[model samples]
Target: MPMLYLNTRHTLPMIGLRVQHNTVDTPITQPRYEQETQQARAGRGFTQPKITIDSYPSRHSYGYTNNTDFARENLERGMSEVQKGTSKHTQMAWALAEDGPKAGRQVGIEFAKRDMEQRVTRQRTLVAAAIPDPVIQVDPGQTHGAPIPAKTTPIWHTEGKAQITYHRGSFETYLQQKGDIHSWTSEGKYDIYA
Candidate 1:
């Protein structure tokens, strides 16, 4: 079971926008024995008859036979532009962390005393666990992408360990499977990636 093959070689030339392709292997279509519709299974299927191929791939090579709006303005002059996101230094780091209004009210009262010491250590470990029944019944259209119904809700959690999140549509499906939206790229993944 020795399988460690990498060979990861991608050193240049991928100049895309190809617009022309080919791959065919067609040759097959024959069943005109007088358009035989089972004449008693072609007279009891004679044993000297077997010709089957029926493979097709000839789409007369794609479309566009000149309805040229200057060939779509030369395919939009090598079409590309579609990148976004620009929070201007994340709104100047939250306006320089709220431009010191009394040191942002002492860092919001030390984050409300560390969120009241994590809600008094989660109400003292839920005082021996047995209060969860609050969901009496919430059929918001058969409950799906939930969490919004709330009279008062801060049930902030995470003693850690609980994953499966991946945001931003799994980062644009991993940047459309390893990005290259027809080239012209720039990264510095926002907030200047720490």
Candidate 2:
């Protein structure tokens, strides 16, 4: 027995290696006008709209999924206010009239209050709906842990945004006459695993 001894090592065969794929959806940044105008240039294959950053003071960032109509309406309101004016300066002038300061002051105060309210409302609307251009990428590894089970069905998920960025003026400084409106762009990132 000692003279005729044999050694053997056993190994298990590997079935298959698991693989994952990730796809990212780019954020929509261009306004509707641009989106439509690009159609002519797009021909057939070019679907994505391209926008250039204007010289106007605006923020470029990611915006969450939102109602474009709402944002557009508010934008129109803001534009209208800019065109027609908020009646703030006139109200102040009336309030400080020299001869009839007392009577004029009362009417001026009312108008001033109304103007302030309108400005605040306008600002909040813009801020609430302002969506800035944002870039989003999905990392499959981060989305799902390693060692995924073999022969599993694909999974779909949307990662909550870390931050929401939007264009337009600040809510705090709505009263200031910045006098311009910017396009709203919104974007979100999602991960699909298979």
Candidate 3:
């Protein structure tokens, strides 16, 4: 099971400038670990194994900004304020769509509604399916960076069909493989905000 811990903070001026915090613990039926076991058994495991990579690229063009000079100035200033780092937008979009196709469609619709160019072009984010058996070995000592089994040619197979159903305030993801089910609750402020 996957454990989620959340803490909410609010100011309490009535009690001599004190702070109040509420903690919520929600246990979730963990995502399947079949991939982890397969990677280990296949000897493709590494000190750091990247199981999933989710990304959301916001391709919306900001609406008109007064005039060209004003836009140019803002662009320069914005570029200066930006720093090189892993962005949270990617994970956020994935989280919104991870619930399933209905939720995923909502994500694209929301993004499309925001961009004025929706008629000409639509900006959307997609969540990638679980990776196949191709695992990367990061240990320098392991096989000198060559993929295990040495593929002669590329082979492809479906990752299986996935469907999510919502009941009450919880959702269950059903996989085609042996009808495996993963459940999650839609509780807490994070759920509301998302």
Backbone collision count in every prediction?
A: 0, 2, 0
- Which residue pairs show backbone clashes in model 2? 61-133, 131-185
Better of 1 and 3 by TM-score: 3
* Worst 10-residue lDDT window, candidate 1: 167-176
User: Which residues of candidate 3, in runs, are more than 4 Å off?
Assistant: 1-88, 95-97, 117-194
Candidate whose lDDT is highest: 2
Positional deviation of residue 111's Cα in model 1 after best superposition, in angstroms: 1.8
Candidate closer to the true structure by lDDT (higher is better), 1 or 2: 2
Q: Total backbone clashes of model 3?
A: 0
The residue pairs found clashing in candidate 3 are none
Query: Residue-wise lDDT of candidate 3 within 1-194, one digit each (tens)?
Result: 45453534333333122233444444454454322122222444444433442221111123333466578888887776563212435544674767436632666556556545655676577765543443334433323243445234334444354444443443334432342333334433333332
The candidate scoring highest on TM-score is 2
| Lowest summed lDDT window (length 10), candidate 3 | 53-62
lDDT of 3: 0.44
Return the candidate ranking by lDDT, descending.
2, 3, 1
Which tens-of-lDDT digit does each residue in 62-100 have in candidate 2? 332246755886899899887666465554565567534
